[model samples]
Target chain A: MAKELTPQEMLRIDLTPPNKDWMDIPTVIKPGIYCYPAKPEKVEIVGMPNPHVWSPLDDDWGLPEDWKETFLEGMRERLNKHRSFKIFMDICVRCGACADKCHFFLGSGDPKNMPVARAELIRSVYRGEFTKAGKILGRLAGGRKITEDVLKEIWYYMFQCTECRRCSLFCPYGIDTAEVTIIGRELINLFGLNINWIQEPVANCYETGNHLGLLPHTFKQNIEFMCMDIEDFVGVTIEPPFNKKGAEILFVTPSGDVFADPGIYTLMGYLLLFEHIGLDYTWSTYASEGGNFGFFTSLDMAQRLNAKIYAEAKRLGVKWILGGECGHMWRVVHQYMNTFNGPPEFLEEPVNPLTGTKFENAKSAKMIHISEFTADLIKHGKLKLNPKRNDHLKVTYHDSCNPSRGMGMFEEPRYIINNVCNNFYEMPENTIREQTFCCGSGAGLNAGENMELRLRGGLPRANAVKYVHERFGVNMLSCVCAIDRAVLPASMEYWVPDVNVCGVSELVGNALIMEGEHDRPTDLRGEEIPGFAKAEGEEEVTEDV
Target chain B: MGRNLHKGLREILVHKKGPIVEKWRELIHKSYPPETAQFLKREKDRFSNPIGSSIEDSIWPLFDQLIGEADPSTTKKLLDNLVRVRAVQDFTPASAVQIIFALKQIVRKEVLPAAQKKGLLREYLEFESEIDRFGLLAFDVFMECRERVWEIKRNDLLKRPYLLAGGMCPSYMMKRGIKHLEKLKKEITQH
Candidate 1:
């Protein structure tokens, strides 16, 4: 006879919450979820406070002796300095409108990951420490003292946010929840609790002028290697100048484009496009990075890293600056760069030398995005584009969170795609445009140890791609972001293996019909063009037969 | 293998498919927090609530495959859709596949009475055994997804050796007492 289960035992899998409130639920820091803590040396290099070795898994994080006072003091300082932070904390009515909008919440199904609750993790402490009624009434007034566990919980969820601002878009009162997370991270960094994936990049960007810390020679050599590939594949020999003074424009891009795959192809696209137009621009080794990891750490650090861009431009005496395909780089540049390091008085307003169109939108920053430049060029019929070159690719666009929401660059990339790729499709309306989902690995959260978090957060974006893949046979997903180029390939491979990720410039490079070029046998990646090269297995099958 | 027994089990499973799938989905929804479970249950749009929509879109075809033909290819694809979502979520390996086992309980409650009256209780026991096998298959798919996640993590690290090489910053090298910064830089360049 088989054993029988009792009535209570029969239904063993119970997932309901405990009798205690969410505040009482202790955070369990799991491996493969949190990133490695920042190294002490990296922290010390930046002269940040309380440099020490620590782990999220440790019972004691080895915080400074005055950690509580330091945290409260930081919070008080932020509340005084940034009125937006103070208003965001005070204005939220617990509307829950932004609760379901977070990708982390949607992916993980954790209530704490909800924007409202995540904010309340800090808000509760604020009320307890700052408000008179809360100090008097305690838990009755929806306030709690900042225990070590509370600090731990705040740190856990703050880093979980990508600061993509998706949730902020949905907030009725315009809470700007990303700012809350930014301030939360700033406070966390006061104790040197930053993650290595972010801190190392910040230190490297400060010391060597790029996130990957490639020295001037190595950076130039990497671009030269890409030039060699362009020569081999496109039958065009080009020498892109580096740090050349008196150039008309200073072209800066995230260093990922120089060193990483897919992004390097986009860099190749930039080289080809510039060469085709005979535009005068120089790459700066000092401002090699456009993306700022310091933006994820703190505002002051972001300003420090971002100062190099304008400084390089002033030194080079370029007329204007043109930025490349990157996500947060644009967010920082468009929204915060001018405020951080500008009134770039040394530079002139950005004007498309090829099209002769003055970019009024970028007049203040004296910087223009690559898509803005390319779109203007195409609109004016400046380039001879062959859309048929991309016929083999059925393409779709992923509105990288920053460019879409932060910059409102909705039509430029799509207009460029229409001119380049014949088979362009939109994902479901809700998942695109201003409502675009994050690639999940934004901010500094795109580290290897946080793979589970990234994958779960990426599901919505990947699911939208899957829908288009099934409906429209969309195989290639393009975007105007280098971080997307770096991370989306892994997400696409995991969620929808059929779709491949690429930069928009890669598509432009494919469709570009350069003067004095040989009959192109391949795209920028050296994969054969559909009509140019023989189909796969055709000759082999004939030989076998 | 008896023809009448197969016919009886198929008819009962097909007739009770609606309630069976609903109860199974409800149990799966329970696996999340109460507020999120309510949201996932209430929201019907596929794009706005993909997690919910994936569960809804998959369970119907999954049930049909379970009761009708049990085609391995179709069933595996359907299971992959559902299991892949849960694999990256905050579930342990056992809890991740436990959703499949909920169907066993649902069947025992919904089909047991009818099967007993129709003299098909033994067939029902065999059917439960089939559910056990399906649970085992779901476990395999879950593990495959978990392994793929690890593979992706490993590949991401390998793809960006510069990040790790850069991690050996000059100050970090000094702190670690590694004197050969030049050697490490050479290796990174070669890599």
Candidate 2:
């Protein structure tokens, strides 16, 4: 039997901070000096020499030696072809500051998963072989001759990074690891090294306009089902508009949230709020996926994935777009998509339909967050909520990285929680707002193959929640990201067994007040919804629209 | 090892009988303006380079060579040309630390010395300070790129290893991953 490797034993080799003036820089010193507390001091791994355990994904990954030539040719073409890519390449410095900031690295004890190191899996080669460093030092300066193995190593590692720009925040060079990952994936894709799971969804998103490949009819069917769930959960028959042309807003959300988990409940919250406030919104099956998996692999894929929303939005002819709660979806939308693609032809300037306020940054203005919109509605007394409905449990909110860090959406979700829930507790100051930790399973690392790492990385976050749970008896954890919903539960099970994770909308659903007795869907059919329907016409408001 | 080789070459260059003073005169003429350059030439000997009586005196001429400025383009051009010379070119103390200290005057004050120890003086030169944190050069560089840095320090949960794990940071994870590959090999052989 193979020996189990403990975290302390693995982390025995510590790079003692070389005494220096540069070490005084808050960003550099904070991590190196304080890396002892916030960052993992040790990583534990068992079942090592699994020579028998071969990754079928790698075998089918279709990466070959010729991939090096193909990738280099592609990189050269990109560098020569586009000014932005060249400038981006020249401007990038592979400082590892962003590496420790990544959720994937935090979750998985795998060092190859660090943003800078993962980037170096490609950038080092770029530095050594492509730059002046290669010409002079050759191999002595850590420059190596690029080979097929180098390309494969780049492919394997770069793909593992979720390209979450959490690292970009700390990167002294402002080198977006996600952007590097995008380039790496693009080079790998040139040689056809895409994983089957991600590629299939990307293809589905291309073909059916949703990652789940839901047909237009099925898409409508899901909306109808959600309306029924809302009637059961929120006591309102919310008919969220479907492909309504010339509508004021087009609501684009990740298909994952629309299909599964806490995101579905959050989806219901958007529908109920839209109905209560009488906002003109539509959902186009064509632009169904706000989350771009293609952004994970290639910029062309990112451009293509993003192009779908505008194409469909134009087809539907909405005035402006509203984004749902998902991490990378908003990251691509706010940071790259609006810049890479041209301004929308069909969407007009988004005036907050309720407040009459105009969002200036068209990227975020045109792309409004659902939480922000809902919070505003509640603030303005548009939607009436029964706070006691959420009395069954105490809840705390986990700020998703994209919405909070990517778009500065810290207040919107908190506002909704404060108004909608009777009892709500906030997490630690450092762990909230822009400094909030990732759910540890974002950036497409939520794959089944990465479960071990996912749980490990989630430890920090789970421990944080455990603090709240233990102190305040907070039973539920609420966050707005779908990936968080998918990954956080696993962490809760492993690290904080008692705490339950839910979407903010789930608590809202529990707390919504029924206007009419028929709002109870479960009583109506015993097939759906939840409770007993009261006498007919007791209230004029109808649950079924 | 590389530094020692460079030092050995400097010693050999200094010991040679060839016009060392003339070389100094040429450097001063190239580095300074016509007025300053001429003054430096007149002060030094025309034939033999004057050996400094002590280490402090010897470094004085090197300092004059470094900071006594002439035309910017011409000075940079001379430095670039000097950097290309075979012995003093790549192996020069100029490449090793001089230009970096000069740059430190502009962007940062004291980064060049520590940067030299890591063999990262060249790489660090490519970066300009953004945030201006004293020791946190990385954050400063990041801020220049318009990036923000956030720290998650553990205040209470010191007992739980999860809260304080290093892999929580992706950079640490990558470093750990590379470091662990060695451990994996060692552990594998141990069994």
Candidate 3:
């Protein structure tokens, strides 16, 4: 609501003859549109280089006198080291195929948020400093020398991007804008500028073996507390082995599953599911978190934190790893982990111990998603499930950004949901599966200060859910990511007030007819289990696995 | 006041509500790029254009409230539905509520000739005063919505410190649960 350009006074941008000098018009790096900077102490705790303190709103970012040279030097180093970075910088035709694909652009209607324009922010810097054609032609060749304002503009939009890679999917040349953002962020971090959301978690994960910085004792307490809930609800006890050496598999998941609500329910789902299947999996407090927040900050930081997972797996003598539902974690596990800190030679391929269904998709990474594991379980009829128990929820699935586009595991989640829930509806074809819209709050942009930005980015996704909510009475939204569980509830509150956001596991927990479990009358949150409350009042319902 | 002024004004404003809404939509969407504006300006199909369709949906009900009943509760209800949405947009309070002024423009364009020809300037002035009153009411809704947005932002700021310290996205668990239950209760009874 702070005043700036009124609607009538703002410049109207049009698709015109190729503009030779894009920098002639300064990008409007608006006030509320940017993120707060990282606290230097947190950056230092993670042992990152140049951990100098700065805030985005300050007049000066406390850069060293040689900050520009440092950025340029880092750019040169990356150009030499990563051929993909050099080629991505060199080869953009700007056909604008990716312009409308970005949720940030579609939601905010900001020209700079467009994928093409966002890439141009750093691409311009690349041309001016690195290319001969740019050095001679300067602004004529889409190049601009870096300035204080230009640095701020670059940092501002880099954080704005969730790096969901939906844009990369649409690029005809497949010029990944995410690659530009990754290296662009790495170069910018040479001077220690990072959003607190990303840097703080990186620091926590480095020191405490988890993003939430839960001590080993406290982490165990959280799991035990959930165990109590499971005992009271199901009349069955679950004592998950933690840091137990010689366990067959290492069970790792995002710590948000332990700390946040509804997510806690899904954690309960894992405990219940593992207990039911009698899988010999062990939880490790050392590699307490599966999510890699460092992946958003810098590659070195990501590698530093991700080292804990494989290190813990080795120390525990586990054969393979099974990951819980998360988006970016899978992205790192599937795409970057092996390249960064893998070959994980000590670990074996993931095979479902109960049914021995080998996960071919994760044979190399030695990790399998819980949905794939559970879908195969249901396929082989290893565990009991009651589709009627979840009759109350006419549900729709939100494909999280990384798993859908980054790994392409579309039908695994849908297959599980269809088998568990009676009424399931897909969002519009364009907004589901591979072409799925973001939860609008991925990649550590799920901060509270940016609620307006989050809401704006969420409009397209919420609109899609609302379509199904109105048409099919879908009061529940199920997803596969802990970030979605943390952020989408707030997004739903603003956009579609009636739809409740939850992890797919919460629904699975509700519907699973576990061994030695009591008759179910309520859901994870103690909400009346809709139609079941009536059925239970009149008749005792019992099912078996 | 002319004998037929109110009826003719209603005919002009109400009968031609389609163009009035279209003109209002154009004014509302003038800020976005033309291509994006096309999406935001779609008057039908809530799925394709939820925000635009919601804005368009308020048009007739608001007109009925403004001219026919002029009840404060009814006016507040219609405008609050739209104001809550516009509050979150990247615009100042003045600019956000500026959409309501489109009503005055629509009245001036659609009924000015009829009112002048009927020599009902007194009745027309009365109608203009009513719009001014509703405009003031809209200003109130806009201020309240802006305050609510800031309130949410302030609460977020308080909770964000914890997220920084421990990588938590904080919210009032009790409040969220109650909100979920309230909506659930409403849904159950409604069905």
Stretches > 4 Å off in candidate 1: A1-20, A534-545, B1-5, B162-191
List, residue by residue over B49-161, the lDDT tens digit for candidate 1: 87898889878897776666677777778788888988998886778888887888898899899989899888888777777777888888998999999888866754454
Tell me how far the alpha carbon of residue A342 in candidate 1 is from the true structure, in angstroms, after superposition. Answer: 1.0
Q: Lowest-lDDT window of 10 residues in candidate 1 chain A?
A: A536-545
State candidate 1's DockQ: 0.33
Candidate 3 regions exceeding 4 Å error are A1-32, A531-545, B1-5, B14-18, B33-85, B126-191
**lDDT at A411 for candidate 1?**
98
Sorted into a CAPRI-style docking class, model 2 comes out as incorrect
Best by TM-score: 1
Tens-place lDDT digits, model 1, residues A238-303 = 999999999999999998888776788898899999998999999998999999999999999999
Model 2 lDDT per residue over B1-191, tens place? 01222333233333431343334334323232232233334433211111111112323343233223323344333332222111111111222223223333432333445446657555444433211211132222223221110111110111123212423422222224435545655665699
TM-score of chain A of each: 0.95, 0.80, 0.94
Per-residue alpha-carbon lDDT of model 3 for A1-545, expressed as tens digits?
12456666564332221233446555554555666778889878876667776667666788889988888898899999989889888888988788877878766766677889998999998899888988899888988777888888888888878888988988888888888898888877877888887887788888899888887877887788788778877778899999999999999999989877668888988888899888898999999999998888888888888988888999999999999999999999999888788878898888888888888887677888998898889889886888887898889999998888999899889988998899999998888887888888888888777777787788779979878997888998999999999889877876677998888888788778888777667776667776766553475545652
* DockQ for all candidate structures vs. native: 0.33, 0.01, 0.20
Q: Which ten contiguous residues of candidate 3 chain A have the minimum total lDDT?
A: A12-21
Return the candidate ranking by DockQ, descending.
Answer: 1, 3, 2
Q: Candidates' TM-scores?
A: 0.93, 0.61, 0.88
- Candidate 2 segments exceeding 4 Å error: A1-65, A79-96, A233-235, A363-365, A517-545, B1-191
Better of 2 and 3 by DockQ: 3
